[model samples]
Target: MLIGAEAVDTAVELNAYLARFGYGQGLSIQQLWAEMDRVWAEMGLDNRRPLGSQRIADFYAHPVWVLNGLFADTDPTSVRHRQAIAAFLKDACDDQARLRIADYGGGSGALARQIVDRLPGRSQIDLIEPFPSDFFRRRLGYRSEIRFHDVLSSDGYDVVIAQDVLEHVEQPIALAQRCIDATRQGGLVLFANCFYPCIQCHLPGTFYLRHTFRYVLASPALSYVGAVPGAAHVLIFRKHGEIDVAALVRRDRIARGVGPLLNLLGQFHSQMKTLGRRAGLSE
Candidate 1:
């Protein structure tokens, strides 16, 4: 497994960091997990209701996400995932004299900072987060290698990462296109999407893309580079140039045609697993 000692330590210290942000006041992990649902209920957010773009943007600015983000990033699975991302990045750009990376919807900037330390070449990372937590600004603010951006810059980046970001957006396709658009030709776009309804915040609208994301986002301009080793969720792709609109439309049609069967099988599997547990067949 690809490991970043410093990043792991930083994630381990998130609970202490949260203390400064007015969280972790005798709060347990379970309570912190429930915080997002609690906020959703307080806001009267209906999962069935689709939020407008601005509303979605504003909702993400809430402080509850800081707690959620800290825990999520610190989880063992997430730490490994970031390690995989860093490994792929290193393999792709290690030989280059300079590297430019953009981490879209990157919550804590931990991954970007970790990359800074691991890469030998001079590198710059732009963290595209609309509402960076106070801890993030305070902890990484002095790092000359990492810069925070509320909006993605038009500059062509050598690598663009959007890990677990598309599921929260109203128009994931639009954002996915933007990720592709921002990359330099032959540069990499790394994506780790969770399109399934695994969490309350993952919009139901995106569930259609759960099985179809790769096909839907397929473009002639983007050559499929395969998934990151040991972390299958994170996909690797190399950009060739401007996206072909006709090819995109065709691929979207293909996804729409094929995704429902996969979704149905997935639902059936979940239902059967739930039934099995209820009958005490398995844990």
Candidate 2:
């Protein structure tokens, strides 16, 4: 549904509106909105009630999980968020692949709900969420399909996704391994959780990175935060345990294209930060 002239204009206005906090800087809002209008109308999208720069940009950019944990003060599924996600997924995963995806531990299936509108029509995406939203479940999987499970096992899936679900488990690595056990070989487990460095000790229970512009300004790292060092996104490939994600990232080169060249260097900063924490914790 997100195609042609309307989407282009909506995307442009969104990019410009999101840029005010500094990160979305210098993007041509007027030109972009003009380009994306057809996209906006086709998608039945509108930006209702303007939001703060940080919240507008953050929720628009990050996965819904990170947006929830980090910006607890704001609504996770804001209109701006919807528009941004629609625009972004169009660029990233607009392929004609029939994906048997699992939204493992997804609450209310909002992620799955949004995907229905954004992805190409009849993509055969199955969203498995143990806790499906009564409201959202009804809406999800119309164009696609969303299967709700009170409990779920990952078997019989092409791509298993657990966004911020891993941190809550005591044995996160074990949980990740279990997710791997569920995924069909060559299927992916898409994880987009927060990263807490080694220097930052675990405070008990589950905690995730709640990075803000102020937080980024104060800290020294510059990458999408992963799980804490002792805790990271533990993915098990069909054959191998780890995917060469960095090289994979290089293949896409989006980080390289977006900002300063040096900004790309910090993607691995969390790994190093974890090592540093391990040294100190061991000492």
Q: Point to the candidate with the largest lDDT.
A: 1
Residue 130 alpha-carbon offset, candidate 1, angstroms: 2.3
How much is 199 displaced in model 1, in angstroms? 2.0
What digit string (tens of lDDT, one per residue) describes model 2 on residues 190-244?
5544433221111122232222211211211112223322223332223233334
- Cα RMSDs, all models: 7.5, 17.3
At residue 108, give the lDDT of candidate 1: 83
Task: Give one digit per residue, the lDDT tens place, for model 1 in 1-283.
Answer: 7759986776667556567545544455567657767667677776678675225554566666776666555566666777877877788787788899999988588688668878844789999997776567767878888888888876899999998888888778778888888999989998888887655788877777888888877767888899998799898999998998777877766776777778999899999998988889654
Cα displacement (Å) at residue 267, model 1: 2.9
Model 2's TM-score against the true structure:
0.40
| Candidate 1, superposed: residue stretches over 4 Å from native | 1-32, 53-58, 269-283
